[model samples]
Target: MRHLCLLVLLAASLAAADPIYVTAFRDPCRAIEVHRLVLANEPVVPLTVVVGGVERQVPAVSVALPRTDWVVHRALVDGLAPATEVTLRFPGTTERVRTLPADLARPLRIATGGDTMHKPEWLAATAKALSARDPDFVVLGGDLAYEDGKNGARVVTWIQTWVASARAPDGRLLPFVSCIGNHEVQGSYGGDITKAPYFYAMLPLGGSATHAIDIGDEVSVILLDSAHTTPIPGPQTAWLAEQLSKRAKRPSIIPIYHYPAWPTVKVSKGEKDPTGNRVSKLIREHWVPLFEAAGVRVVLENDQHTYKRTVPLKGGQPDPGGITYLGDGAWGVDVRRIFPGLTWLAKGAEVRHGYILDIHAGGRIAVTAVDETGKDFDSVDIPAR
Candidate 1:
């Protein structure tokens, strides 16, 4: 009887020490038929990821942090039917993943926010609230983990918290799409890629800071670096123009970046730029024209820690047919005060919130702002462009 009890205790210990703590999905972009899963494990064990009936070996890579127990593994499950569900069997657990529809014939929900993880409890609350809404995927503009380009352990904990609290109502993990923020880098601005080690190590950004993802055939989500690891001008601008030109015909072209080109708060004390904020000047000069030409009706901007929505803007002026910039990223952070009498702002407030974008059939987008309690406070409807 004593030996049997000891064996049972041993089994319990092994169960508690399960290596896989973090599991996240990525790159549900143009590949409607494939899904990518990124897993972080504490032990370096051989993993065979089984999706549907097919099996694939996923090799683990060591995270480039000193004295850390975590390693990263990725698996790509392809040949999936759009809008179908599949079960992924990984070692000791299973996860349900769904693919996006090939066309926008049905409604899809995408939740987006930024400036996350200043406080773990706030992040937990906000993530749980967002999860209850059951978005198909999430796009975080940046400032995730607040690790300041270091502190790998903090990044790990943040991911664990997010995966735990942000699961779908059906217990499936939602795919994550992210862009680089100032907090992701060591120097905070205009630095080399090596400074932001933790961000690149965890995310599958194809080794560059800027990339675009197409949701079905109607919407294109363009994620930019916003001067974190990559600058805003020259090559990045050229690439932005090219990407916009290629997807110019798409009904919705949404750009998600860390800095707001139209800020609700001052960039610095005593700043007097007629453009509102001087920090985002380069983005205004370089990328705004491209956005106007491409007919990008909506843009997602973050990092100011206040809720904001600019009037439909053309050349910094309000126009009926122009782009509407939403956000100054107050997700899971202390809200900031909006500058008084900002002529460009249609609405500005001190609120901790995120956006739920309901993309319906026929290219219409219903944007709803939800607070940490899962309550809707603001909403706007954008017609098909």
Candidate 2:
């Protein structure tokens, strides 16, 4: 009789548990998936979620977060109309998710930045400002959460904060795209994927962190690992070459990564080498050539906490016909100082900001930098090639 009473109490406790964090993501910008990380109070059974009136069962998968009892459930909903709103019904919550448009004729707006979640207040302000812009999606260059790949509770808080603050003006949740940075791993550099467990669990970017996704038919955004978990040379380089080659004729092929090839701040002499030794050098040698050859017009880079835009350059010299690099992070973190006498830099500033890229139908992108106060600080116009 005692064992039966204890078992009844356990079952009742599990039945009353609710989800802690529920958010949606677009992996390839086409497939929409929802992840629900249940609260650690109790273990819950598999639950059914309704996506667009269709019921799908989501099973709970145990997440190995140190000293945490959180479990995650995933549900992928397919065959939805583009640019349309779909309703997602979890047990006690309902969220509206907007799908990316499939038509290339319509203009698209993307807001991007990195090095976020350092200070909670700054992150909330930046997220609110970006949400007010009402962008189609967001791309983070990395250093997200600042969890150091171990603090799972911090990671959970970060996600919850983002989901709460990063909503469109119309109240729809915006999808997220990201790359891995040094802070995402335990070693901070040159470590394997095992070092960044929360990143893999939270953001499912296929298997590898480096991958490419297309928005409509005109633009291709390539997200790179930046030597954090994956090396700059070897198979990643080969994959990059192939992706660029395949999209050679694409109107806009933009690469978003963590480290900058032409850094705004000065790197120590000890970090530079000729044989593609460092992250920046390896990118310049192995990736920049591919980018230049493939006619990549814009590159988004982060890590150094300052805002910077480079002059169009080819072969290390400013040229009218060359790729332009935008950004040195500064989203929700303190700004850094830029090295003086850098000829390649067209514009640089010490400010917390994010980029709003308005991609037109013909591939011309009007880039605008907006600060935490939602004020525009800088603007650049890139013509279609």
Candidate 3:
């Protein structure tokens, strides 16, 4: 009778624990898939979560983790409505996940800023500016840090400033993607693939299985190695051609690289830096002809530390339907004269610190160039596809 009385009291006490609850996924850009429901306040029980009434286990997520930062684990559920609020519940919690509005009638107000990351404080400000705009996905068009041949530890420190310290006013982590930059190349010009260890380690975004996430596809994004470890010939070259050819049919295609084919500033070309090395050579001679032939839309170039939008040209002459090349990356760095305008440039950037980008969505494309002050320096509305 004494034991029975004790059992009854224990059962009553256990039923009173709070339901474990918190936001599961914050990324508006990630494909609608199952994501691990992590605790904002870590708990001890290794709690349980149920999506659509199917129970799933909660995994350990720690802010203290640097290498595994931004990773979701264990559970993955799919087939979700975009930009909709969904519910999730755990024994002690329940939180509402509101997906980003999937139906963005206009260009998905995306903000593109790069190079604001060389200094830690600058990244904080960059994060602040981005948090205010809350772009669909932030594009780090490279040169995020000035490691100058540093170790991964430096990356962790820099990431804390560039990524961790960043938060939306609503308390969301601004997820950004990367393209290779000159600063990322260890030698500042040429280095082996291994030298760029930290770059790939941080952003493992290349997906070979899924075309959308693949390095090159419709809406293809070709990340060039520059003259870094991977030369523009051989496999990289073959792959580049394959990607460009594929981009011909896609809605939009963009190419990103560390250097320029039509350099805004005069830098000594490497003796070994063939036309292929410059990218303009093969890209123009081999690839551009194909791009023009196929209809590749944009080629994003950097390294001049300035902003420029090259006229759409075919064989060096202005061709209205040719292709547009924008950039001369000057994100966190200072700049020279390469003006930003519809016509102020083959190269005219008298200002510094800006990011150039295209907003791709809803069968419509728009280009907007934002200066460091977060002002729209120039924009063009590309007609819907």
Candidate 4:
């Protein structure tokens, strides 16, 4: 009788949980199938794809979620042309997912921003402005939720905000890729992966703390962990070197991390806490060289809560034959002052804004910083090398 009562309670609890489902950014991407899926309370849900008036059920592998009612599944659905519209159906809902450019000959618009600390007004306004641009995808720099992803219910609200804000003008959901920042963890640093339960549970980036995602043949985004969960100059550095070495021949190699390698507004250099200095040192000593050698034309960064652009430099000096660092994420937060007396610093802005990157063929790129009111405050153009 006791066992029966417990079973009934469990079933009732799961039944009461709200239904939530969202798509994740492709990690081990094939450029053909949507490999990431998040479905709550629906295990082994059917995914139907419609193409040319033909509907077929796709096979999916359900991943086990411990201690939660949410179910995650991955499906392999291919054979669709790029830019072609296709309808995907689940148990109770249907959505349209756009395919990549058929020939990879045109430009790719990407929205880049971060530091959304649970401010609903800023989030909604910025999201609304971002969707108007019709970006192909979004890359966030970190500090996703003000709750630090420690509270379960708060994390749920954050996820709901993220998903709701991801709708484009065409009504298609845009894919979001992010790097873990200090706010994602409870203590902000020196904690294991378990410290960020909601981050790991919600965004599955190939089960690795650091990973890279290639967006067609034009660009490869190498996402690094800036001492949040993993240390710099250690295992993640080795992996970054390997990934960059292999993709060196590609047209563009861009790196995006939570902490800016060259911060615009900090005088301490993290001497109080050794972790901060260590992260800065490791990035400067180990990773920057690799990026320079690999022809990384640009680097995206955040964590300073301001807008900044560095002069093109080679080996940390102002040189035309070097990479341009654009960053200091200003999403849902107030801006801070830029540190003075830095020769490498080209331009800096203290404003609440985000960036829109227009990547064109032959390695030509343009970045624009736009505030929450949909105003373009600054713009930079990096010509083809």
Error of 2 at 17 (Å): 11
Tens-digit per-residue lDDT, 71-189, candidate 2: 45556656666777766666665677777776666678888999887886777778888889998878889988888888887776677678777888998777777899888899999
Backbone clash total for model 3 is 19
> lDDT of candidate 1 vs native?
0.75
Q: Each prediction's Cα lDDT score?
A: 0.75, 0.78, 0.50, 0.71
Candidate 1 on 1-385: residue-level lDDT in tens? 9999889866744533332332223336322212222323335444455455776655544454433445455444445566766665555656665666657666778889999888877887878788789887788989988888878777766766676677888887677778889898999898878898888876755578788887767777899988888888889999999999998778888899998898776556567742445548888999999999898888999998999888889998999788889998888898988878788888888988889998877668899988888898988997776
- Candidate 2: lDDT of 179? 91
TM-score of each: 0.88, 0.88, 0.67, 0.84
Model 4 C-alpha lDDT per residue in residues 186-241, reported as the tens digit of each score = 78876668777667765655565576877777677777888877878678888998
Error of 4 at 30 (Å): 5.0
Candidate 4, poorest ten consecutive residues by summed lDDT: 27-36
